[model samples]
Target: MNDNDVVRDLTLDGNAVAGLLEEVFGADMTTADGECAHCGSANAVGALRAYTRAPGVVLRCPACGGVIARIVQTPRGTLVDLRGAAHLAMRR
Candidate 1:
């Protein structure tokens, strides 16, 4: 599909992922820091523009408008793709 076709489906923000992230990462991940792989924009995951309506959830950078992450659920398991993020800094 075209880029617009994909982006037109975005309907939420990183805040929408708090619960799911807690399940997988064991804590609130929305507040974590993330750097964009495409444009090097560094910001909190909560700051990323999130689209929750689609076959999967898509997160994009607010500064450069590049995709930062994608989360999909399948029959086997939940798949989280982070290739769009160059750095995912979590609190220790």
Candidate 2:
């Protein structure tokens, strides 16, 4: 496939994570604040970048291109990884 096709296959907006994050956190997490582990920049989870290619979805820091979260859906279950995020602020 061409580069455009590849990008189209893998690329997505951060808003795509809203539903999954809500399922995980039991609330709307799109407006939640998160800090990038790599650059320390802070922003809303909905403002990050999203990639949905390989076997799962990946959310990246908009500031330094750091991976903020990863979500993989398997036959048995879904796995979520947030190792690249330093901190997340939940609403009160």
Candidate 3:
């Protein structure tokens, strides 16, 4: 196998991380609205495609398949990368 051949074994819906998201964000983020920075497609967080087979969790846009977010856990703390998301709107 080559390093380029990333084996993504499983694909799940964002809803699968409901408990994790609530633990991290302290709210139900699955219902949040997010805009993809790459494709500019707006979608609910629950609708984003989720891949958890890697070291971290990856959320991808359903429209363009652009990465929307990455959540990784480290010794010190958890790392959240949202560069792929233009903005995430949480309901009050």
lDDT of 1 at 77: 93
Query: What is candidate 1's local distance difference test score?
Result: 0.84
Q: For candidate 1, lDDT tens digit of each residue in 7-70?
A: 6565567888778777867888888999999989799888788887678778899888888888
Best by TM-score: 3
Instruction: Report the Cα lDDT for residue 52, model 3.
Output: 85
Q: lDDT per model, in order?
A: 0.84, 0.85, 0.90
User: Would you list the clashing residue pairs of candidate 1?
Assistant: none
Over 4 Å off in model 2, which ranges? 1-10
Regions more than 4 Å wrong, model 3: 1-9
TM-score, structure 3 vs. true: 0.87
Instruction: Indicate the worst ten consecutive residues by lDDT in candidate 1.
Output: 4-13
**Colliding pairs, model 3:** none
- Worst ten-residue run, lDDT, model 3? 1-10
Clashes of each: 0, 0, 0
Candidate 2 TM-score versus the reference: 0.83
- Cα-based lDDT at residue 41, candidate 1: 79
TM-score of every candidate: 0.82, 0.83, 0.87
lDDT of 1 at 31: 84
